[model samples]
Target: MSPSFRPRAPRPGPVKTQEELDEMVRRMKGEQKAPDNYRERSLKLHGWICAKCGREFDLANLHLLTVHHKDGNHNYNPPDGSNWENLCVYCHDDEHSRSILADYLRGDNRKK
Candidate 1:
């Protein structure tokens, strides 16, 4: 390398084109993965109930809800869907908060 050679500076302009935006979105979509049926069973445990408030929901409303793991481990999936539980939105929120808090206390849960 020549000592006199200098590296170029980076450009500072913002992205402005639809193609640029679409490319960015496409890159982000690559990182997402859909959950499987074992994961789907948690919604059934809620039994038309909202985890957040224990209110019974109609079929349509419950359909919009989701089953979640109390732990952050997506790999802790239960077999035969027996580990499933139904919880309305509110309860789900509380469960997540509690799980984080517990992990913090135990010192096993660190931000990855």
Candidate 2:
């Protein structure tokens, strides 16, 4: 004869009050660090022009400008802005596509 299987019930955790929940949320918010503003820093260092195409930009079209990491590492931002270049959307797309094509041709399918 086979024994019937039964699952164990979940253990109940201590319930937090509304004030406790709010305090926990407040503590989490306080512990969070401000996001890196590397784009603005790169723009300031490299100027408002595309590095590849030399396309100029103004306040109106500044949104189209993007910061490209030279080493392709987003987390490798330096305060000196050594690894960043300002590129327009078109040039940035071309730059990434070229790299992808190169990797494909070299049979290197690893994500960077």
Candidate 3:
């Protein structure tokens, strides 16, 4: 049999101590940037109301409220809140469904 056909044993790597592993994890976490709080900023700027259905939201039911990007680009958030719209869960679903249907009708097979 050729050398290429021979099975090779796995190479052993240096095992890390618990303290070393913990330190590595801590350094990784520290190096990571905090997630953007655009949702909170959008809620503050556009009030707690759905732009499409005009449904209002309060602290108790604020979970149903979501921030939507007007231009369909999630990364195109502006500080002035021009591209963001506060939408209720139902309206948000409907808005996405309409866009999907429109795209289907137009034969847009490209994934968004």
lDDT of candidate 2 over 26-57, digit per residue (tens): 99999999899999999899999999999999
Instruction: Please give the TM-score that candidate 3 achieves against the real structure.
Output: 0.68
- List where candidate 3 sits over 4 angstroms from the true fold: 1-32
Q: What is the C-alpha RMSD of each candidate to the true structure, in Å?
A: 8.8, 4.3, 4.3
Candidate 3 local lDDT, 1-112, one digit each (tens): 5568668887899988999999999999999998878899999999999999999988999999999899988888889999999999999999999989999999996996
lDDT of 3: 0.92
Clashing pairs in 3: none
Which ranges of candidate 2 are over 4 A from the true structure? 1-31, 110-112
Give all candidates' CA lDDT scores. 0.67, 0.96, 0.92
Candidate 1 regions exceeding 4 Å error are 1-35, 38-46, 51-53, 70-72, 75-79, 105-109
Candidate 3 weakest lDDT stretch, 10 residues: 1-10
TM for every model, in the order presented, reads: 0.45, 0.70, 0.68
